[model samples]
Target chain A: MSVLVFIDHSAGQIKKSSLEALCYGAALAASTGTTAEGILLGTVSQDLSELGCYGIGKIHQVASDTLNNLDARVFSTVLAEAVRSTGANIIVFSNNLSGKAIAPRLSARLKAGLVSGAIDLPQVANGFTVRKTVFSGKAFANVSIHTEIKIITLNQNAFPLTAGQGTAQVIPLDIKAAAPDVKTVSATQSSGQVPLTEAEIVVSGGRGLKGPENWGMVEELARVLGAATACSRPVADAHWRPHNEHVGQTGIAIAPNLYIAIGISGAIQHLAGVNRSKVIVVINQDPEAPFFKAADYGIVGDAFVVVPKIIEAVKQLKGVA
Target chain B: MKILVCISKTPDTTAKIAFKDNNTKFVAEGVQWIINPYDEWYALVRAIELKEKDPATILHLVCVGLPDADPVIRKALALGGDEAIRVNADSQDSYYIAAQIAAVAREGNYDLIFTGKETIDYNGASIGGMVSELLDLPFISLATKFELAGSLATVTREIEGGEQTEQVGLPLVVSCQKGMAEQRIPNMKGIMGARSRPLKVVEPVTADTLTSVVSFELPPAKAGVKLVSADNPAELVRLLHEEAKVF
Candidate 1:
């Protein structure tokens, strides 16, 4: 029984969430008394050996540009072959967009029991049970996978990335790439911005901001704090912000280290997406806003006045001009 | 064109989540069930829009649940589905649900299969991929925009940093999310028409149940909020730095 972690990367750079998956997978392999390995499909510019710091003993690379763009069918077919050749009984993935697409297809192909949005390592002592978030983070469910081969997609930020001293052996695995059925027509990349899923801190605004014209303060505050900017459902619905920047039940769910809400009243739908944040701070003029109940710290003030002040304070504290 | 749209019944977003039966089963009492917003607002609505563009298009809805899921299916019918199918089984395992839908898809031989990105309850986001694999068809997930021309379908899906538009052949499975279509309310005529729509109930196909839930637990409650006066914005910053230590 061995563990294999899928190393997800975008444009040759490894995602931060994959580093956490490596840590989780390596620890799980250690607890099970087996070797942990990584499988990288597509080309990566970074030195593969550097990833050993996350605890994997070896990495299997399938270096081909054809494997770059995510085609779930082709990726799953290759992964199923990798699982067979490596004799791996368990697989781990960071539950991001790519993982969400490929993991289940792989699970169906391999007839392996799969669990997504897992918050922690499996309880190996008792039949390989995994705890995952359910009800949009409102509740948790401990799901037991009965199949011999188990698949788990770890939630983003659920596991901390711990670096250690070691170098992983980078072995090139020879596998024929399947012809992708999906054809890529055009691709637009959102560059130079902190991706919301990986952001440690997020500054989000809502309808209370009044209009899209007032969004400069939110962006200024996020810039000073080095945080990503997010918006509520209505903000996105009204086209005040892009749908990708929307964080709510129907949008991207995040669990940042610190989530600051400005001019946003916490609807249950909005709260469901962000309740998992380690710390929540709400700034709204209405003290009766539902968001205060879920916030760690709150200030009943107009966002127009309050956000700029907080931005100045953050700048002063950080010694930024 | 025949399109099969998959939907699931979930507790209303505002419903208070609580588990009963030793935390193994969700309490069903006093809970209002709605068609998962993603399925209703995006997947089904997009299919309905396609049907509207071409009156020859046949739109069907498939769901996997017990009788209680019927009302949710009816709501989708009211929204614009021409027909519905409910597999006579209830299971939390996504693979099982996908298998049932795949069976229905296989029987119907749909030109396109649609499902939401993920249900609001489990947020597994696995069904579309699994069903595509089961049917041996191409699958695109989290599609924000979809347009079909002849046998070729153009779909734009959300990727890690941005978006990617892909073209694929028909008999495809695509999971819908925001930006695919606008949400529509059912009028009196649509509601009355939904009652006469045929909803076929079939026994579930044999599929392995690979996972089982052992227990459920709510998230730990917050200790309570600490309020700082608006005049003391700097104090709030200090508390965030020293007390929270988030940075």
Candidate 2:
């Protein structure tokens, strides 16, 4: 049996997380002594063969316009059919927005075991077991999949994206597309910003920023550092930032290469979301802020004064005016 | 309209997380449990708002847990659910839990189904999709806004870069998140009323437990933080560049 990776794309562009998923699937397939193949449901503008650099040997494409927008029910139906036709025993997905919507449905359709938020490769020498984050990254669990057909959704940024030399053979799969019951009324795309999930660096602020008007410094620092801007729950609740920017246990959980928290007290709920970052930097006025304990570096300072200096320093380092 | 909102009980957000039984089980001792925030703040509250608009809307709460989870279910009922159902099973398997919810939904003939995007404990973000698939119904996940007119539902859900608004027919499932509705605390009157509300305990339908936890591990403790003088922002930047190499 072969391993199948769901190559998720939006507006004809493949997501960065899917690249990691492809790499992960390829490695898993190699370990199991089987080839890794990719399944693309919607049409994309990029050359599908180029994706082979990520180690996939083949791509099963169902190029249909109707499959472009996410309709979990319709997508799952098509994927389930593909899995049966391709004889794929292990399915891989990047646990992003689209994957989160679709993977569990696929598992149910196939009666396969699913482990979402998987952080590492499965151990196959013994029974197949996958390590995944539980309790919102506070704890980890090694879950064994008993079902013959297994499914896993890899956490974004958890797996490194490795590219090597290969060309994927693109084979068109003939499968009738299901008419989507969910009609897309409209879409408002966030343009000209690195999406939080895919961002390598994130600069977040809490109530210490004081108000929405003072967000200029935060944005300036983020812009200079080429990082995405995020916020704490209180800031989002107070309308200092949009709810989408909230990153915490109750909000979006992000694991970036570097996460800078300004003015945040680092409540347990807040730490639960961002504890997985590779390195954390905390800048706050209060020395007793709980965030300092979890941080890799701490600067006890006022956001108004410290942020602008950091911005200037970053700009100087990047040779940006 | 009949709405079924799935609720889950999880450890309190501030509870001390630890393991028992050689790290195979979560330490439940002295751990206070609460209704998962996503379920209480978004899913059930949105259903309550809908019921407020349409007086005839029947709101039913469902949970897959043992009797220990009853208090959480009762709290959900106090929040606004007219009735509640608890599947008497204490399993951590998401597939089996979804199967139990699907069984209840199939028998109830619900017009709308709501679930939080994910539980605070496992953070699986899985149940709604699995339940919808098992029931063969359209599923909209991470819905931030939901509006219903007749049998057509207009839902706005969060995507990777932005937001997308879509319309679906009734008898669909939705996983609610922030912006769907504000969190509501049960009033004394509501809490008293919940005492008399019908709480049904039903036997779980047999479903395969596809996965089992072999072991648990806590994240490694962080090394002590390296403090920098507030006036020395440049030094901090240099350290991040040279030491962390994050840039």
Candidate 3:
């Protein structure tokens, strides 16, 4: 049985998360004595052979314009057919927006066991057991899939990418595709800012910044640090930032490497989403702010005073004006 | 319009998580249970708002769990759901839960189904998509904003660096998160009314579970905070560069 990894792309380029998934699937294939292959649904600009360095042997490309925009049902049907024809028992996907949308439906269609948010490779010595984060990154659960076909979606940035010198053979697959049930009307493009979910470093602000007018320092720090900008729920709720920028239990959950929170009280809801960050830094005037307890490094000071110095330090460190 | 809101009971956000039985099971003793924040704060609240907008809307609450999950269902009804359905299944497998939900949705012929993006406990985020596929309905996952006008519904969902707005017909499923609606606290009258609302306990459909839990483990704890005085903010950067090595 071979391992099939879903390679997701946007604007004709493969997403970084897909590379992580590719590495994870390759490692799993190596451990299980199976070949690692990939399936691409839409047209991509990247040379399929170059991705061979990630250890994938072959890539099945379905160049359908309709596949460009993700439709969970349509994608599931295509993937189910691919799995049937390829005899791939293990499927892998990145547990991102598209993965979350498609993996579960695909699981239903294939009647396969699925483990989403998997953080580790399966323990295959005795049985195929996968470990995943649950309770909003509070704990891990080891799930054993007994189904003939099993699926796993890896969390973003969970696996390290290992590169090897190699080339992959690309083959085209022809399949009957269906029109999507849902129709897209419009899309608001995000600016050049880093994607919060995929960003390695993030600078977040809460109500402590006081209002939207005081957001300049937060943006400056984020720019200097080369980090994405995020906010607590209250800031978003109060319309100081767009709802999409909110990062918390009720908002987008992110686990960047460096999460710098300025003037934000660390609420449990907020922690549920960001507790997985590699290192947390909090800057607040109140020393008793609960965020300090969860942070690796903390500064008890006013945001107005603390953020500029951090930004200046970053600029000086990076040799920028 | 008929809507089915899916809910689950989860440990409170601050609950001290512990595993028992050699880490084979999650310890429930002395744990405070509440309606999953996402379910109560987003999906159910949005369904209630839609019902308020149009009196013709009928809201139903569904959960796949044992009898102990009834209180969670009651809380949903108290928050404005008209009726509730509890599928007596103990398995936390998404396939099993989706099978049970699909059966009920088929029996009820509900037009719109809403579920939280994922339960906080399992964080599987799979049931809505699985159930939609099972029922052969359109599935929209991680919908932040949902609005209905006549038979067509408009939705806005998040992408990596952007957002996409889409439109779909009725009889679809959506996994909801923030921006859909605000939270609703159950008032005295609503709580009183929930006590009388009918909660039907149904049997689950026969389905094979694809996965089983081998164990539950906790993530490594964070080291105590290392404070860097705000006056010397450059030192914080030094530690991040020299020690944390994140930059």
Q: Which candidate achieves the best DockQ against the true structure?
A: 2
Winner on DockQ (1 vs 3): 3
What interface root-mean-square deviation (Å) does model 3 yield?
1.1
DockQ of each: 0.82, 0.89, 0.83
Q: Rank the candidates by DockQ, best first.
A: 2, 3, 1
Interface DockQ of candidate 1:
0.82
Kindly report which residue stretches of model 2 are placed more than 4 angstroms away from their true locations once superposed: none
Q: How high is the TM-score of chain A in each model?
A: 0.98, 0.99, 0.98
Please write out the lDDT profile of model 3 over residues A1-321, one tens digit for every residue.
899999998888799999999999999999999999999998988899888999999999888989988999999999999999899999999999999999999999999999999989999999889999988888889999988999999998788878888898998989878999889998877777988999999999999888999999988888888799999989998999998899887688787889999988898889988998989999999999999999999999977987888888888888997
Residue B133 C-alpha lDDT in model 1? 91
Model 3 bad stretches (over 4 Å): none
lDDT of each: 0.93, 0.94, 0.91
TM-score of 1: 0.99
- Chain A of candidate 2 gets a TM-score of 0.99
Which has the greatest lDDT?
2
Ranking by TM-score: 2, 1, 3
Candidate 2 interface RMSD value: 0.7
On residues A1-321, what C-alpha lDDT tens digit does candidate 2 reach at each position?
Answer: 999999999988999999999999999998999999999998999999999999999999998889988999999999999999999999999999999999999999999999999999999999999999989989999999999999999999999998999999999998998789899999987788888888999999999988899999888888888899999999999988989999999999999999999999999999999999999999999999999999999999887998899998998999997
Report the lDDT of model 3 for residue B82: 85
Worst 10 residues of 1 chain B by lDDT: B157-166
Candidate 1, superposed: residue stretches over 4 Å from native = none
